[model samples]
Target: MALKPATNPDVEAATIELTIDGRAITAKDGVSLYDVVSGTGKIVPAMCYHYTFDPFGSCGMCLVMVEGKKAPVRSCTAKATAGMVVRTEGDDLFQARKKAVEKHLSVHPLDCPVCDADGHCELQDMAFLHQVTNLANAKQKLIPEDTRSLVLDFNMNRCIACGECINICKDVLMIDALQFAKKGGFTQVVAKGDQPLACEFCGDCLAVCPVGAITNKYSKYRYKPWQLKKTTTTCNYCGDGCQMIVETKDREVVRVTSPLSWKNKWGDRSETAKG
Candidate 1:
C-alpha cells in the first residue's frame, strides 16, 4: 500500500538557511537562532532561556554577532531568517559573555562545593567554558535566605535574577505565587502577598532554576549531581504515566525529575505523562 502524504503543511515547507560562524545551517522559519545553533551542536550559554517558557532574554550569556548589527543580539530572541548571517563564537562574543558571567558571579556566593547543583549548574558550566578563574572582585551582597517553603529553599544571594522561576510560576503554571519585587539592586523574588509560599508543590520552579537559588529542601545536601546515576522511567502513579528521571546514588533513589523537552508543553509533568 502507498503511504499517504504527510498532512502537516508546515512539514513540506522550505527550510530557512542561516550562517553561523561561517557555517551554514538550515532550520524551520520562526524558530529562534538559539534553537538552530543549539540543534547544530553549538550550545549557547543562557540562564533564563528555558525551552518550556518564552525566552525572556534576561541574561546576556547567549549574545551573538549578527550581520549589519553593531551590538551583539540575544540569540534566544533573535528569529531565524533566510540568508541571515550569525556569528555564535568570536572574540567580541566571548568577551561579552565573559562580562555577563562575571556580573552574575559578583553577588553569587561560592557555595558550589556544597550546593546541590554543584556539577550540573549552568553558571558553573559557563565559568568553566569561559575559563573564568576569578570571581567578581566587587563586594558580595549578602541577602538573607528564606526557608519558609516546605519543599524548596530560596537563597537570595545565589539568585541572578534570570527570572526563570518567576516566569514559570506565573506565566506557564498560571499560579501567581512568585514575583519580582523591589527595584535595581534591591529587586528579588518573593511570594505573592509576602506570605509563605502556598501553591502546588510541583517543584517545576526548582527544575528550571539555573542556579541553586531554588532547590529541593528535602534533598538538599543529600548528594552531588555527579554522584547520581540517572534512569529514565515512566511514572505509574496515575493513568497519565508522566516520564520521570530517577536519580539514584548507591542504589538509593535520591530525587525524581520530569525531563524537559520541546515535546513537553510548559514542562508540565502530569500533562506530559498524559500525552
Candidate 2:
C-alpha cells in the first residue's frame, strides 16, 4: 500500500514559497526542505530520516545545493523559506551523495545476500542507487553481534549509527531501554543495565531499524522482504480500529505491523485487552 505523507501541523498554520531544482513550490513555513522536495518528483536519498521522527540530520545522504551557499546543506534539517532556491539534483550533488554512501559502505558489512534485510535494506538500496562500487577505505573492524535478547538480534557491525532506534525507543516508545554508547567509529547501541535487554518485548526497536542490525529473532532467516505479500486491514481486536499491514507467504501469515501513530497509543496493551 502507498502511504501518504503525514501532515505537519506547523505547515498548516502558515505557508512559504521556494524553488526546488528550478521549479517553484509552496510549503508550510517550518517544514523541512526534505519533506517538501519529497512530495515533488525529486529523489533525495535519506538513510537516517524517518517521517514519524524529528529530523536528526545524522546521515549526510540528503545533502542538497542551496543557492548562495558554498557547501551543500542537509535538506532533512534545513527549514523551507520564502524565496529560497534549492537544487535537488546535479552532478555536484550526485558526487556528494555518492561519496557519503561510499564512506558508509567502508565500515558496513558486505553481507547483503546473507542478511535478513537483504531485499529491503535502505543502505543497500542507496548503494545501488548511487552506483557505489568501491569504498575509499576498505578496512572494516569486527564488532561482536548482540544476541542476548530472546526476541531480537543486534549486529553491531551492520549498524550505521543513524540514531533512529535510540530516538524511537526514547521519544516515541517512552522506553529508555536503548542508548548510544562510545564515540567515533566505535559507537554502538546498547541496552540499559547489566542485562542485554531491559525493556518490554514490544519489538518497537526492530520496526525503526533501517538495516539488519536489529531484526526479529523468529523471522530472521525465514522470509525475505520480496517473498512476502502485504495486506492492509483494520484490526478487529482493537476498539481504535488501528490499521495493520499483514505479511503473508504462501497463505501463511508471517508478521503483522501497524503505523507508528497507531502503535504509540495502544502498542503496550495486549491484543485481547484492546478489543
Candidate 3:
C-alpha cells in the first residue's frame, strides 16, 4: 500500500525535494518544513505546533539548520522549498532548542506534583528529553488560577504562553473563545473580555495546552495519566463521526476527551466544531 500524503488530500500541491540530516526526502511543496521533517520519522520537539491548524511559532523548539540561514530557523513556520538542505540534529541545534524550552520553564510554576497534566504534559516530556536540569533563575509567575469556567480551570502560573489553545480555538474550531491577555505582569491565555469562559466547552483547549495551565474541572487532581485507560470511539452526539477518547478509571467513566490533543497531533479538526 502507498503511504498517504502528509498534506490535505483535497488540494493538489507540487512535490518538492529536500535533504534532512544528510538524507534526501521528497515532500509536499509549500507545506510546513516541520511536517516534512516529521514525515521522515524524526521527532523534533515543538510545543506551539499542531497539524490541525496553521503554524504558530511561539514555542521556538522546532529549530533546524538550513543551508543559507546563519542561525537555526523554526521549522514549523518555515515553508518547504525545493532543493533545500536542512539539518535536524547537532549540539548547536540541541542547545538552541534547549534555550527555547528554558524560556518557558523560567516563568513556569513548579506544581507538577499535584498538576493534572503531570504525566501527559508536552512540557514535562520535552524538559526530560532535553535534560533541563538546572535553572538558577527560574522565576514563578504566582498568578491566581481562573476557575470560572464550567468544565475547565486556567492556571496562569503554570502556563507557558504557547498559544496552542488559542490557535486551535481560533484557527481550527472557529470558536475564537480564547485570546492572549497581559495580566499580572505576564502574558496569559484567557477567555474573551477577560471574563469567564463561555463557549461550546469542547475541551479542545485543555487537550492542546502544553503545560498544566488549562485542566478539566471535573477530573482535576483526581487521576493521573497512568491510572486512566483511554478508549477511542465515535461521538454519538452528532452525525459527523468525530472521534473522542473516553477515560476510565477502574472501568468507571471519568471524562470524555477529543482526539485533537497535543501528543497525538495529526489530521484536520476544522469540522470538529460540529462534534
Model 2, 22-104: lDDT tens digits are: 78777777667777787675668887776555778887999999999999999888877789898888899999999888888
Best by TM-score: 3
Which 10 residues in a row give candidate 2 its minimum summed lDDT?
A: 266-275
- Model 1 lDDT at residue 1: 12
Using Cα atoms with residue i matched to residue i, what is each candidate's TM-score against the true structure? 0.82, 0.84, 0.91
In model 3, the clashing pairs are: none
Model 1 TM-score relative to the real fold: 0.82
Report how far residue 53 has shifted in candidate 3, in Å.
0.3
Residue ranges of candidate 3 with Cα displaced over 4 Å: 1-11, 267-275
Among all windows of 10 consecutive residues in model 1, the one with the lowest summed lDDT is 266-275
Q: All models: lDDT?
A: 0.74, 0.74, 0.82
Q: Which stretches of candidate 1 lie over 4 Å from their true place?
A: 1-15, 261-275
| Candidate 3 lDDT tens digits, 1-275 | 12122334356677778899898887767777887787777888888877777777888899999999999999888888889999999999999988987888988877898998888888888888889988889998788889999888999998887788997788777899999999878898999999999999988888888787888988888988889999999888777778899999987999988777776774433321110
Which of 1 and 2 is ahead in TM-score?
A: 2
Candidate 2: which stretches are off by over 4 Å? 1-13, 183-185, 234-238, 258-275
